[model samples]
Target: METKKHALLSASSSHKWLNHGPIALLEAMVPEEESSEAAEQGTAAHAMAEHFLKLKLNQASVLEDSIYHDEDMERYCQDYANFVVEHKESLGENTLLFIEQRLDFSPYVPEGFGTGDAVLISDKILHLIDFKYGRYYVNPENNTQLLLYALGALNLVDSIYDIEEVRMTIYQPRIGNVSTWTMDTGPILEWANGELKVKAMQAYKGEGNLEYGDWLGMTKIKAISKDRAKHHLELRKYQLREAHLLNDEEMAEVLSHVDDLVRWGKDVKEFAQKQAVENDKHYPGFKLVEGRSSRRYVNVKSVEQRAAEQGIQDIYQHSLLPLTKLESKLGKEKFHDIFGDLITKPLGEPTLVSESDGRPEIVKHDVNADFK
Candidate 1:
């Protein structure tokens, strides 16, 4: 039998659509492909991690080669395995580990389900570990996805095991982060019954207040809710008329609300472009054209040799220092050992961003004073 695919209110996107119920309806209208090539590669890496875990579990398994297989994947998987081994005591005696485990939280939601990367079940605690191969930091604290997974796993094993506290972990080895959030079963269930159930019903039925918020749940829908469309139009009009004329304080105040509209515009543009190419949708005046490309040396060794023969002193002109390329040349461990504490990342230039952006804001201690 084939497995069930993710529902519209899938646990992974609960953090978004749960916060803003209307996005679920909007998302249903537009066709969406898998997010990106990075998502596809993440899936492949997940399969690799599953295979590795199963092998360690004494199951018949074999390592498979995939386009996504690389040093990062290998390192991340190994680190995940190490975490599992190191946490054996916490898992209690005679613990069993499940890989690529399907968990269902449909009791609270209409069609809520998610797959956990690793589920360590024991008498005392149920550890729900998720592997994130992406460079972005995924915190486990107050993470709806992890909480949903924990709830589902608890529901599944409530009868069999005397599980008490649930440990939700996000293992992002690429960023050297392993965050764990623990909560007792009583509170987790309380949250599901209170906040999760209410929000989920609102999203599932698509009947709730429709207002633009700081949540990252905007979708590409031309004729969305009448109220929402009217508000967006007004905001756009306001932006065009008086945005540039605003003082610093006024600009900052306006930005908090206007950022959502700006992001929605970007989402709409992206959606139109994707639809035109992927589904061959026709636009009145726009035609799909080949994207711009840049020339690159196919064989760097040959190019270097030819350059040396031609007496070119600088084969690589206008080059910038890239840490990845440097690590590739010198080997990561060796490069780190040599440049230890010598290389430092400078403070990035301040830029306005939406509140939904997960990156920590640079809290400046020193500020330039000037007349307003």
Candidate 2:
């Protein structure tokens, strides 16, 4: 039997288990969600990046697929490969680079292991670069996932090289985020001995109680523990029903849980739909039905011919080519030379978020100030 992708104590999900160690035990009972198209695309992107970084040019260009292959993917993967190679070269000829390196960190976390996208070991520093193809910007500061990968890489190479520090990079080219963080091996080992080992043990033996928080955002815990999610959200409704108004602090407290509750509700609905469609799983009071469909011409060329016969010479749509398509055709230099002056970006509508969110808080303004 194969080891499950949702390892009880996987490095990728250290953030979740570290948040609440007992959630892993609860998570094991829940079936894994089917991979989404976005995830499949990310896999394809990673494969492309790996090929470019590990193979010669003749071999790298063979990733031909209509479904996920496109100009943007090729460009991004090439950029990632270039970044990794250039960085490795900067470290000198003695630096060894490994692609898709499997690492084990069981010394710290019981049964903990994961694959690092790329790892470079030099004289004193071991740099681990992870290629993130998703649009979500991953920061490298104190990220438990990256920290765990760093530990695993150090464990793999420390015996061979005298590594002093572990440096990790998160390259998310889709959002143009290349974030890096570094820590000395001594502190990393200290953390591994302290918080990491404690959480891993607690999670492995199923020893802690599940609590409600934003960590629920990770594993769709709502599917298995719908009652718990509902109960947690019930406080918001109970507070709303009370015959008194909430002040700033109380409202803020209630608002904190609303986002997670909404996400959980949506996940539950979608999970049921996927189960029904993919696995033939049935849900009471929720029969699957076809959605409304739109009509389209089956033979567009025949339709064009028929329209032309009816004296409809202009029975066609005309619109400017998308900026990206035009740019690719004209090349970046020519495209910018001609249309750079014509582009404008309007301010986006404001969105509410947690105080801990990295984006700068939106400043308030008065409508009358512009006229004044």
Candidate 3:
């Protein structure tokens, strides 16, 4: 028997491959991307949360500190801890807690696995909590990623514990959104056995309706492939064919389709550029261009010494006001009373924006009308 080294269908990326099977095969071939700074911070926050929970669970005397501590992260972790405390009574006496626990759902999906940030197994209910440091709102209900994690958790403790129901919670404390979804083990398992299984098998085989969807993972992979390029070429041909004046309704219809095509084109181009930079590959008639650089003082002391020798004591000093800090020092009302008269609205450069954008639309006015 050949043992699989990696999970073909990871729970975190279930949203993508499930919707479009070919993305799974494509991602399996491509090199993994480097984590962004925000992702790194989120990892650190998770570590801090786990450490804090461990101390709390053990009833330790002193508090352990984290070097990667941030004010927002600390506040978020505290919120998660508080939630656990609130539900402690319902959790029962034989409550078992786990942090960053690896969960396997191999029976449901082929080599499917995920890590739960916090798992609490009790008599009849299992509570799975996930901490999201991202700014986007994450609803626990109908969230494929969290549901997959729930399945993984069930696989781990369903046999050992009398878990009839599961509670899935998403804590996005930065946004002050705590969403919870509770369901019986029957429905969850049913989903796993049904849609999840079909998709996983189809994705694993790399054969199915492989089309782009709203899922970011699917979009990102498709954006860097020849499939997207072919679509782009077809779109351009159609665009030229329909480049004519139209009625208001026709214009709206055209824009509805054109907007999506334009966005996809932009995203695909950007992805290709990033891939080129990473792999040291070049497109014909185009080469990698170095980003603009700025000079910085390596030795501040040496610069200061040189300035002092030149009889300039305040050479390194500049008079600049940090208005926001001053506003914080003074109350908002008081700050406004003092500086409100000086405030002015300047005309900004015009740009197109989607209707969904919350910013007030720029309304043009005729200066000639005032003269008239």
Off by over 4 Å in 2: 1-6, 55-66, 235-257, 275-290, 296-315, 321-337, 350-372
The digit string of per-residue lDDT tens for model 1 on 1-372 reads: 765675878888787677778677767776555567888888888887777666655678787677767665776786677777567646666887877888899999887888988898988798988998898789899899998999889888888998888998888877889889988888889999998899999999886655654444334453234444466666454465644676777676667667556666676677678778878998899888898999998999998898899998865668667887777567567888998678898877888886768789877655555433
Best by lDDT: 2
Cα displacement (Å) at residue 351, model 2? 4.1
Question: Model 3: number of clashes?
Answer: 0
- What are the lDDT figures for the candidates, one per model? 0.77, 0.82, 0.74
Give the range where candidate 1 is weakest over 10 consecutive residues by summed lDDT: 216-225
In candidate 1, position 154 carries an lDDT of: 88
Instruction: Return the lDDT, model 2, position 8.
Output: 76
Which of 2 and 3 is ahead in TM-score? Answer: 2
Model 3 Cα lDDT, one tens digit per residue, 1-372: 975545778777777788878777877786666767777777777777776676667654333465556554666677677777556557877788777788888787777878888888888888888888878778888888888888888778766876788899888887888888999988988888998888889988887876543343244465666555554455353354565756677565455455556766777677668868877767788777788999999898998888889988756556656776665556557878998787676877786656766779977799999999
Worst 10 residues of 2 by lDDT: 55-64
Task: Give me the runs in candidate 1 sitting further than 4 Å from their true place.
Answer: 217-232, 235-245, 253-265, 274-322, 328-331, 338-347, 350-372
* Top candidate (TM-score): 2
- For candidate 2, the per-residue lDDT at 5 reads 60
lDDT of 3 at 211: 59
